[model samples]
Target: MTNISGALVSLALVIGIGIWGYKLLVRDVSGIPVVRAASGEMRVRPEEPGGELARHQGLSVNAVAAEGVAAKPADRLILAPKPLDLTEDDHVTPAAMVATAQQDQAAPAPVDQTEIAEALETGNVEELVAQLTAGVAPIAETEAEVEKVVATVAETVAAEVSAAERQVAALLDAPGVRHSVRPRIRPAIPAEVTQAALTAETPQSVEVDPASLPAGTRLAQLGAFDSPEVARQQWDQLMTRFDAYLADKKRIVQEARSGGRTFYRLRAMGFEDIADARRFCSALVAENQDCIPVVTR
Candidate 1:
């Protein structure tokens, strides 16, 4: 009976120790300052701003990091740009700007629009040409007189040509004349020469002397003068200018009249034949000197 009581006492002590050990391990575990894990590390409940407990509760570290990235320069929020201050005291008006621009630019020279307007209004070709060339004004009476003289010269030339043709016909009919003889043919005059003869002389007032030219002379006519004296003077000038061509050659101032208007032709005489005279005239033309072949008979 003693032994049995001793065993029961021992069992009660063991039960008491087990109950105390369970209470110390579970109920008072929060009271412990630190708990060592298998790796000898102290287990801790993280209480940082972005802790595991906070992350699991929806405030994650990734979300906070994303917010930080947005705060950087790439995603920095910018304030609205300010509008232009148009009404400042230093601002310029459109009128003032235009006036300033005008002051900076140079004014153009004034033109004589009256001359152009007059040229357009009158429609007189000679007057317009005179104005353009700044030459002497043309006289209507002088032009009419010149035209009459030209007509007379043309008639005289026609008469001479007809006389020549008649002479040729007469020669062909003569018993003494050779049946096989070919008549001399005149060369065609160039348009340049015809145009020059029509309107090349410069207007000059001078006295005239009427005298006939030497017959059967093949000459080159350079120009016509108002007076025989002027023609002689022009010949002297031309001789001095073209001494090589005029050397050993004779010059004559021949008189011609038509419609009571006298004209003195300046002629270079002493060509061998009509062909020679025409060739010399061509040479003169090449030298910018106007000349026309003339047959005196």
Candidate 2:
């Protein structure tokens, strides 16, 4: 009997605790409550927390609201409007603006075309040349004009050249100017004979025996004359003319066989010095005009 009574008390305690917990979990709070409407219906008034219902007033809730939903005011701040009269005086009229643009678009004043054409056609070259020379402007521009200027210069030059040429020609053509004509004489030996002779240490003076003291040195044999008698006659004529001064002179006769003829030669003998001999020879040369200096070994 006592064990049955303990079991009945424990079951009553468990049932009372479960009922209190169910009431506490479903309770409303103290705030504005959220409302949920049906699919195509609108909410008239949202329920308040703590089971208090509020009137709808004029709020327009959209028909698509979910269960227990409500609308609230936005959190953004609003800006104030600016006054329009502050900038009212800065506007321009449309007509006045169009007239100002037209003035800017108009073409500039035209240049004088005739003056420009004249300036381009007659450039400043003549004016520049005139300024450089400090002279009057030139008017002519023809080939004849240029040729006339050239001819004037040429005439002046020709006059001076002709005067100089006449003076030179007169000097060249003067009379009685005894110009000497030296004959071309070839040595018996080769052309290098003179060079060899200069280096040969051979005596420059003629060789003679003292017995022929005033009887000149034998230079060279001149070869045979035309005839021995004719040669003797020529020598006697020379002796007759200068024998007084040539008394102590010597002569040289060279004989060679040419065409099988024998010839004799006679020349003036005895000159004390070569200068004396040359002077005598030169005098003879002036008179007879045929003698020359002879070289011999």
Candidate 3:
């Protein structure tokens, strides 16, 4: 048992010496150091309890110090900015308000209905010029604008005038309204009057010879007979009596056969000197109801 105790004591002394050597090697001597993360941030770790050397050296310490200084500057800049402050008195003043009210009251009212209608109908440039001279503010901004409006109005008026003139001219030139006049003169005498004068100058007498007329002229047969002997016998009896009536103005000029029958005709005295044969034939027709008078050529 005494030998086992001596061995355990020696083992304990060796483990204690080994632990002291490790603490002497790892303990920080100068200062606790900082380290940089992969994202370029600085961070601190606790120093080893019994170390001899520092872990973070010059480059790592300088980088952490720069990050801390940059963070401090950003915070100071954030704290330095301030919002602007304004009071109610910094807005509009009483004098400016009064001036604006006065300007609103001084402005002209809208144009009357009668004036607007007259302006459209007349399109008078002289009236517009008068308005400008009277200091109507809105319309008379510049000479160019006024002239442009006047030119537009004048063009409309000119077109209307031209259209009316064309309508009037067309009406005057219409076919029914326009007429052509021609003169007619009458002659001293007409052709019909000359014809009448010539007819009056001619002779009115007509000469007829009874012997040249047809044999049946004096005794016209009333109807047809079946036999020529019957017709001739009837004609002879009528002529024998007719001869006595005609003896005072005429004589028997000839006897002829016509239409398969015989007839005797009497020739009158001169009708050129006196119209006795026509008068006798007229008398014979008047006296004998069955007789008809026929004048020969």
lDDT for every model?
0.68, 0.53, 0.51
TM-score of candidate 3 against the unseen true structure: 0.17
Tell me the lDDT of model 2 at 159. 82
Q: Highest lDDT: give the candidate number.
A: 1
Order of candidate numbers by lDDT, starting with the best:
1, 2, 3
- Ordering by TM-score: 1, 2, 3
lDDT of 2 by residue, 12-32 (tens): 778878887766666643344
Stronger candidate by TM-score (1 vs 3): 1
Residue lDDT tens for model 3, 272-294: 32244444455455445243333
Q: How well does model 3 score by local distance difference test?
A: 0.51
Clashes of 1: 0
On TM-score, the stronger of 1 and 2 is 1
Please give, for residues 122-151, the per-residue lDDT of candidate 1 as tens digits.
875576555554533347855885687667
Best TM-score goes to which candidate?
1
Candidate 3: stretches off by over 4 Å:
28-97, 102-129, 134-297
Can you tell me which runs of candidate 2 are displaced by over 4 Å?
A: 1-224, 257-263
